[model samples]
Target: MGIPRALLVLCIATAFLSLGPRGSLGRSHLHKRQQSHGRRGNGGHRLQSPVDSPADPPAAGTSTTVTPSNSSSDSSVFDVRSFGAVGDGVTDDTEAFRSAWRAACSVESATLSVPSDGVFMITSTIFPGPCQPGLVFQVDGVVMPPDGPQCWPKSDSKHQWLVFYQLEGMTLRGEGTIEGNGEDWWSLPCKPHRGPHGSTLPGSCDSPVLIRFFMSCNLTVRDLRIENSPQFHIKFDACEDVHIEGLSINSPAFSPNTDGVHIENTRSVTIYNSMISNGDDCISIGPGCSDVDIQNVTCGPGHGISIGSLGMHNSEACVSNVSVKNAVIRNSDNGVRIKTWQGGMGSVSDISFDTVYMENVRNCIIIDQYYCSNKGYCQNQSSAVYVSGVTYANIKGTYDVRSPPMHFACSDTLPCTNITMSEVELLPHEGELVDDPFCWNAYGVMRTVTIPPIPCLQDGQPESLQEIPNLGC
Candidate 1:
């Protein structure tokens, strides 16, 4: 008896499950039906079934097949050149995108394809709304932002850029790049003035993110290079079931608040097989997020993956069941950090960091319950964000500084608890561990194989006052 071709394809996909980056497992495979229709050829496009007409309900028992259509479709793919989009490598291609988007919406399983050449300038937002399932926004050219400040939209009612709102079953894939002409937006004159903690700046001038998705679901973004945004490169807010893989995001090292990936109030988000270098935290998971997993990511020259910096005034947030494993951090500010503002209300629990590698990072591991504002100013009100059940296992790293490799600062009011560390080893950059290993003024208990005596500072100062005290373990 011979195996059916569809069964053979399924077996092959299952075999590739563990071969690629950790995030690509289980979900990256093309649907067996899609493969049977036609083969995916050059340029990373997949042939997909025609999208069911809007009048029809989605295919039954076929919910898992909402992947994006490939670029090499026979007739449904939109060639940007046909719609007056000049690929001369210098013309503004924004209008070309608008035209292509408009045309793709009319067809079932259509692809808006941009061939590999030219720079397209996009000054306005392109809305691919009421997107049908199996629709793909494929880019093979560069999408560049307007050159200077004059081109950016002001915050007034007149200025509105790109946005993807209330769309379902969409896929954005490309081998090209999206560059935000950020200098113009970042240098706006009407920008907010500085405050005591840190100066307020202008809201991202609609040029902050090369791609923005809000209130979307079943979205997949893969195999692209996104660079140079005035703000966050990719931001997902209030979205669900989002999968991002095989992306390379690079930007200037000093770009302020240029977090590589920011997910707020989202669920079931997975990020894997990506390299992120940015000015702020490579990945910041904030309030109202759950079931988030990050694996096989490379991070360096950024703030590193962080949870919380949460509990802002009158805000209610919770982060749980988050896991990060098999990651590499090089010369980052901190590894596996959790921070919360004082006087805020939230709860972060059931978090785990496993098999993480750190090289020359500033702080190998940290949890700051008293995460004060800039300029080292502490809030008079204490934190209400409860931190508990954080575990660091199989962590091996080197700290570039002489201080204790591990630091935990819990609030005086709601102290952190149930913190555990196992098989954690840290090599100091300058000196050996200090003679004592205990927390300072922290309300929670510390458990380890050996609790060394707390080190006394030269001036008899409390542990909190001492900067980078030696951990004598």
Candidate 2:
């Protein structure tokens, strides 16, 4: 037997969701419900609106200049307009942008500039590079896709747009916007079914991710505004030494699969001082990612940060040395989470979530090993991913009254071990009483008394690992 075909195929298209986006009741209803349950005494604050900071990226079409750093010996600049790019949003700028990239990348320490007068309409394109040292790709105007899904070229793969491939020593920064113009794509009959009463047709989903960096290293992307992506907003795959900061990502809360930032097969990464609100995860850490540091992030109106749905379909996965601190997650589905599928083998270790504050969050801490999607059929499997050395410390929050504050549903065959939690306190946003935590096949110690307490956790791993008959992966 091999990995399940359902999991293997769906893993790429829908990584974080088993079901579609929940029908939003609006935050006002939740606030009133919480107030009715004596939530005023629970110390949970009201939900916050999207934040606008002074350091945020400038509006589109703002006048800005792209310049090389003082350390650069070569200060050549390549303007896209000089390469025959019409700044009007109607003309095709894909070839022009590519031409500019080639010229700037050929010269050492150069800057590729997008003028700030108008929108630059571009098709799905790749900017491949072994670019000159200290290269900068600066955007100072709006860059957008075609009008809608109807205008999309059938020849292009609907899986990706705006690819930055195989680049080194690059900085992509500016006060401009990369808009996906994805309103029509989200209304596809097979995509989450936003029709009458959420009805849908049975067909394939072919939504594209907005921006991606593949096989690149030593990159910096900062001070950019990204919006209305068809899928994951920004993805970094097989890249190293990536630094991202001062970004704002926004989308409707019902846009499916719009993870704010996703990293896979990447190392030595840092994401800080950002705001993300989408229909899916704010930050999703995938397989082969380690030495990651995330701090000073604000997330809401979506799924909070997550690690994995890793090792799906019996694939090998090993993730370690991740830390998240000084974060706020409010009015979201789940806070910090780790989810994996059954019958997969590998390990996730050395992770910590610290100093996280939550408001009206559902399932603030979770690890679900039997994660399945689309109500897919999954048979019992004996092999499991080993989850160990995870810690949740200084976590204080008010949770939605409907579900328990924490849930750990580990594999029965290979249970999660060495979990540690301390200074944890959770109360209902609407109720005076806190819900009890749910645990199964997980071993951990709590350094302090948690609200409602966790008594379902057993002392150690089960003594059996023998496989039963007819278990499929």
Candidate 3:
């Protein structure tokens, strides 16, 4: 017998409910449920689940999912554009960037992508983090600051811009640009581009560093372009285990204090395969640095790689185990230098500069122990930072005719010792006469024949070491 209509309808409804939704309909129902629960998308205006959930970990090499702001439903990448960011280069995207960083940094093994094809204008912002492991900050667009110093807010931090503070296991890598727009800052009356006959200004004259990482560790910054900073382009302070490669740093040759990369109190750093051209030192290694390796660098239109200017203001410094090899420095002020001020105590040892080629450089190889650049008078003191075990080998260069090719102006009381030079040659570029290498209170041995002659360096350790405490070769 045929079932009654009501009974048949009831049976079909029961079967459908027992079996649940299938295929496309099931997926659609789940999507709607996630939407109702306020899940956000990961990338490109798509929907995604909340990052705080105990979701399944991503597969090997797969990007971890993050729920971006605005709850865009569809993808698993956290795109900054979805979070109320107008990339028109005018609107302030600072808030959006901070929000994105917050959301992205919350999840373990996530990526925060900055989309391309537009310029993102951000004011001075700090991305502070003790974020999860494997966090990737991928930038594929132009991240520019305000027009110049005139547009900067008075209350903003004058010491730093774009700071990544206290972050670990972070990677900042991409094919993008970070523009400082520092024309106005450079033109200030106190800067090198001093206004109106280089007159000094009385007001606060401090400028911000473009990118700084302070008290952070295990960081990797690669494949990026940083340009036109008001002060130092990239600075790492009190950080450790950093790797910086494939970078391009550009600024005006006359812009003051625009050091390409300045590191202080940092260790285990490797800076390789980079190009740096700025007003100040291409790579400035400050005190408390060790185990640093810099190679395959192209530096010009700036001061060459430098160690110290340490022991300044009567402070002690200890630096060791630095190696710079396979570098080309052209039209620079100094090729390889180790400078320390008087009235301080410490040691700089186990340093080597090898296979360096210089062109038209002034003071190709120098060791200035009495480094006094300030206007104040510095009294002669027996205390000094001891310089020893420094080897300069395979250094071939053409120096400017104005200054001596090699200068070693060691301390009078605490003379530098154990300095070695091998296969070094420096010829004058402009004139026929080559200036002599001046040596004062420096004791070392020459390994081979040197151009322009370095016969001034004495043999064996200096007798002054017996008088100074904790001093040796």
Best by lDDT: 3
Candidate 3 stretches with Cα past 4 Å from truth are 1-76, 193-201, 375-379, 471-473
Candidates in order, TM-scores: namely 0.73, 0.81, 0.83
Residue 283 of model 1, lDDT score: 90
* Superior by lDDT: candidate 1 or candidate 3: 3
Give the C-alpha miss distance for residue 321 in model 3, angstroms.
0.5
Better of 1 and 3 by TM-score: 3
Off by over 4 Å in 2: 1-75, 193-200, 460-473
TM-score: which is higher, 1 or 2? 2
lDDT of candidate 1 over 264-302, digit per residue (tens): 889999998999987778899988888999999998878
Q: Kindly give the stretch of ten consecutive residues in candidate 1 with the minimal lDDT sum.
A: 31-40
Q: Please give the ranking of all candidate structures by lDDT, highest first, separated by commas.
A: 3, 2, 1
What are the per-residue Cα lDDT tens digits for candidate 3 across 98-156?
Answer: 87787677777776677655567777899988887878887776777766666676678
TM-score of 3: 0.83
lDDT of each: 0.66, 0.79, 0.80
**For model 1, what is the alpha-carbon lDDT of residue 45?**
20
TM-score between candidate 1 and the true structure? 0.73
